[model samples]
Target: VSSIIVPITNVMNDQYCYQTSKKIRQVFDYKRRNGQYIGSNPPFGYVKDAKDRHHLVIDPDAAEIVRLIFSLLLKGTSKRGISFYLNEHGIPSPSVYKLEKGMTVSNKPDGNTLWSGRMIHTILTNPMYTGDLVQGRFRVKSYKVHQIETVPEEEWVRVADTHEAIIDKATFEKVQELLLRDTRTSPQGRTVHLFSGFLKCADCGRAVTRCSGKNNVYYACATYKSRSRNACTMHSISHARLEAAVLYAIRQQVHLAVSYSEVIAQINSAPIKKNQSFRLDDTIHAKERELAKVTRYKQSLYQDWKDGEITQQEYRDMKATYDRQINEVSDVLARLTAERAELANGVDKEHPALVAFKKYQNIDALSRELLIELVDHIKVYENGNISVKFKFADQLRRIAEYIDVNTAESPAWAV
Candidate 1:
């Protein structure tokens, strides 16, 4: 009797424990999906709102540090460099800062705490800084096991626009792009070169490696210079000449962007041409009528066959013809309707390319920030020539096309 009672009590205690854990997880998941802040502490840049513990509000001092981290990364500073900069400036690491704020944290320091490259990397990569609530990054393996495991990114709960953002979306996206690239830093340098990961060899399609000559810094094809010479030729170009050419190209683009902006403004101000939309509407109406007539003809074929006015084979052939015509007319109507909607929408003056280029209109020198913002990559030819593929290339082309179509004649500059 005693043995049976003890076993029954043990089983009941385990069942209660499992049920409690399951209920807790369900509650947390519900909060996370609803964009509530479930974490004990907000991320480094923000603090829990006084009125609502589930909401986050920016903490000015910490938010400034967060912005500095992003700004330094954009300026080509390496993660290690940023960490060193913060430590040298006597700024506290996230854990240290939290301790100073009298907040309880699990990872308390045993001795002097210092910032690290990994910490900087984490801060830079966190999308929470961009005003989104992302939770469930890690979860317990099971109620019984109690082992933590990383959750796949797709499985993580994300809710956008839950709080004020420390970093804007575009800048955050740009940082993510840069992180994926192989932007190596120069030896004994704290920051990457202006074209660290941007230069590519036009011949072999390999990265262009930077070299130091007796007096000048130059870049050569990585395949030719480091790997077998038989693989590719030296597409070497001096840094000064390349920089000058790139600066000139950027200025040309800025000039073009200003011109495009003015043309777009003029186009926007002028009343939209009703004739274009009217023509599209008329074509759509005609197609709709054609579809209706074909559908009616298809419906009449069955009656004609029943009345013996047409043979079964003749009715089948006629029905197939009408079906084809109906499909064709329906497709035409869809296309015409889309065109009419586009005509009504008109050209956007604040197109990203126009706005981005206009921001750097007075550019005189090239910086890593500017290059990352405007240029996608620079292809170096064996003939000492470089081709820069700028960002928003497609948008620029669309803007030019829009101007050409709307204006009486193509502007001489545009041509």
Candidate 2:
């Protein structure tokens, strides 16, 4: 009798465990869908709301630091340089700041409050700073197994506008773009020198870095620096010479853009008329129509299956195919529509990037904004042959093609 009672009791306990697990999972899923901040602590730029633990509000001091980091980045300061500035000013890193506020962190950095490039980079890249709530990045394997595993990025739960933003979306995007470029810092002045990441090895197509020279600074092939010259050429360009070359190239383009009617004509014509501009609109419309047709077919699939026209498995398979095609067409249609809208709106006078060269017409100096916007890249050959590829080169060529076909009034540019 005792053995029978014990077995029954074990069965009852297992049933209770199963039900409890299901209920807990349901609660977690509901919270995730509602865009709550589930983490124990808010991100660096924010503090969790006292009454509503799931909501976040800007931490004024941390928010200011975030803005300064972005501002310095736009001004061409590299991540290391920014980190140095923060450390030198005795500003606390996020972990340190939390600790000072009497909050306990489980995995704080081993080091002190000294800032590092990695810390700055993490904040710069985080979408949370843009007011997007991204959760479920890691999860327990199951109820029985408590091991944590990283969820793939595609599977992470994301909801936008969950809180006030510390950084504007445009600035965040621009900072991301800048981070991808060749920006590096000098240990000398805790500053990022001009043309830090701009130069590249013309031969191997690798990035060039600055290194010690006899009595001056010189740019050398990064590959050579790592290995030896046997791997790549010096591909050397001095700081003074490289700066001058870049400046001269920019000044030349600015002169042409401002003084040359041809440049103005190209800038105007490039957006107004693309040979494929009409094609983009036509393709989008076609895809949108396809999506509608697929949707209509999907609606009929259930009825067809109900009337015994197709097997259950076949009905499901065909329905899935139609749904997938519909999604694909919708995505393509959206992208093409955005492209068409952007080109159409480029003619607006208030658009800052539209014919940006015009703003620098009376230019006396070059800014990071101008450098990034106008120059795609500069290639330095071993023989000191510097090539500056203007961002608008392809557009200028297309404009020339347009003018050639439409009328003979267009002036041809001489190399």
Candidate 3:
């Protein structure tokens, strides 16, 4: 009788614990789906809102540190270099800072706990700094086991715009892109080269490797320099020459952008300007009507041949012509439809490219930050020439077309 009573009580306690754990998990899942901050502490750059623990607000000092880390990365500084700089500057690591702030926390580190490269990497990779709530990254193994395990990324809960952002989305995205590049720092230098991971051979399509000469540095096709010269030619351009060319290109683009902006401003400010959408609508309607006429003509061919109104050969010939016309009109209609939709979705006045160019109007020198923000990549030809595919190319093209269509004179890009 004693054994039976003891076993029954133990089973009852286990069942009760399972029920409580299941209920708790359900509540937490609900909160996570609703973009609530479920962690013991908010991420380093943010503090839990005093009025609402689920909401995160930027902690000024820590947020500044986070911004600095991103800025340094964009400027081609390695994570290790950034860590060393922070430590040399006597800035506290996140753990030590939180502890110093007297925040309720666990596993507090000592004052001497220095920032690590891994710490900088973590902060740079975190999407939460862009104002998104990213939770459920880790989970207990089970209701009863209580062992922690990393949840797969796909299973992580992500909700956007839950709080104010420490980093803008574009800059954050650019940092992520740069992280994926071959950003190897120079052996003697603390930062990466301005064109690191961006130059590619136009002929062989291989990356260009940097080479040091007696008096200057040059970049040549990786295949030509190291692998096999037979596979590619030496698309070499000296560092100074490349730098000068790139700077000149950037300056030209910046000037063009400024001119385009003024044109856009004048167009927008004009009292008697044409309605862009209305023009697009009219074009689309004309194309639609032409398509309908051709389609009707195509459908009439079959009836004409069957009713003996025309010979089979003539009917076939007419049908083929109509089909060609129909296809041509369809292609035009599709393009016009897309253009109309774009006009319907109004253009962004402060487009990211426009804003970036506006911010860096006088480009006397090229910095890593400038290159990363403006240019996508440089294609190095064998003849010591380069073609730079700038970022925001599509947006720039659209703006150019807008200017050409609206303005009475030729647009900047047209020239």
Candidate 4:
């Protein structure tokens, strides 16, 4: 009916088609603004709740599989290894599982129900696993055309705590780090060597390459590998020696972060705007509570109208009143929330940056996840000496010089 009407209205050169399209988009935007999941399908680990299809609930079986994939990846298992493990154990692939649940899925020729590295990779990297409802990732180019275009990431509609998380945010973030971090895979697509692109020759400033087998693993300068020792020395470092040193340095960095308060103390003679910040925080919470209450009341009014307890005109007027109040409260809430975030946006002992390192003190085994989190690079020298530069290494020096020396701190410092 929509297709027939649109083309027919266009023949008459009327505004009807355009107006109809605009109204449809308005409804979609309103639903999106209200945090509704407007997609036809929930993500792999989730299922649409029976009570409300727009709401998502954890599918325990699929969610368990998702968790297992993340766990294996964090433990330094390659995507290929994960795929093989799942397939070898006769575990159904995501597509197969989706088919079993009566959702649309496809299988390839020969009835082989094997999981591939690509499939495992997609699951590991999906942000939806972290309890965030991420939609609007793709959209039609226009109302007239059906071609789908990838929406800019910034434009994605995301809502947090929409459903139970299959994996923690930390784990999800770590997986993303691993994906984007400069790392190489072996013949079997496993990262046999932990420090791949991160290792460079000290003298030549070239990346070090991993050469040799299980009996002896070594990272030699890339220049030497390409042009032999004339261009650069081996800068040879055994995996064991490099791993042990780098691991120790990372733990020290975490320990250093613990005492960062001393540096902060020099900057702030008095405690942070304790009273003002505290009050602002309290006010933000109160406003949020008010917003929730108003939203619930507005929803109740809709039911009241449906039950004929209120006239349609009265319902409309009440809803408009509630919506106006919601908008005013939301504006205040956004401003205060932004101010609070600005005040609290640095690495403390409790910050995820430092907390990640603090969680692993002993460092019995080094994984790529921890390596990328802590170290920026490892430079190997010809004389078998190596140095590990950590991520945010510059931040420590800046923290020590907390007062910008030339400029006084902003009054918002106590924000």
Per-prediction TM-score to the true structure, in the order listed? 0.78, 0.65, 0.76, 0.64
lDDT of each: 0.87, 0.76, 0.85, 0.75
Give stretches of model 4 more than 4 Å off. 1-19, 103-112, 190-192, 201-206, 213-215, 223-234, 254-355, 392-415
Q: Which candidate, 1 or 4, would have the higher TM-score against the true structure? A: 1
User: Which residue pairs does candidate 1 place in steric collision?
Assistant: none
Top-scoring candidate (TM-score): 1
Q: What tens digits encode model 2's per-residue C-alpha lDDT throughout 1-415? A: 9999999998899888878988987887788779988788777879889889999999998899999988888887778888988888889888888889887666786866688989888888888888889888888887778999988899888899999999988778777777788675666645566676567788898888887768988888888888777988888878778878787877777665554455435556664443235445567878888888999999999999999999999999999999899888888887677666655543333233336666676666667766766777779899877998877674554333333433333234311
lDDT of 1 by residue, 2-28 (tens): 999999999999999999999999999
Tens-digit lDDT track of model 4 for 286-356: 99999999999999998999999999999999999999999999999997776556445532434444455
Q: Which residue runs does candidate 3 get wrong by more than 4 Å?
A: 1-23, 108-112, 141-154, 275-338, 344-351, 408-415
TM-score of 3: 0.76
Model 1 lDDT-worst window of ten? 273-282
TM-score of 4: 0.64
Write one digit per residue (lDDT tens) for candidate 3, span 1-415. Answer: 9999999999999999889988998999999999999898788889989999989999999999999999989878988889988999999999989888988666666555999989999999999999999998888998778899999999999999999999999889999999988787888546887789889999988899899988889999999988997999999899999999999998888888888777878877778544254455667788888888888888888998999999999998998899889889888888777765654454455766688777888778989989888888999998999999998887787676566656654335545
Clashing pairs in 4: none
Q: Rank the candidates by lDDT, best first.
A: 1, 3, 2, 4
Ranking by TM-score: 1, 3, 2, 4
The regions of model 1 sitting more than 4 angstroms off are 1-20, 271-344, 408-415
lDDT of 2: 0.76
Backbone Cα, N, C clashes tallied per candidate: 0, 1, 0, 0
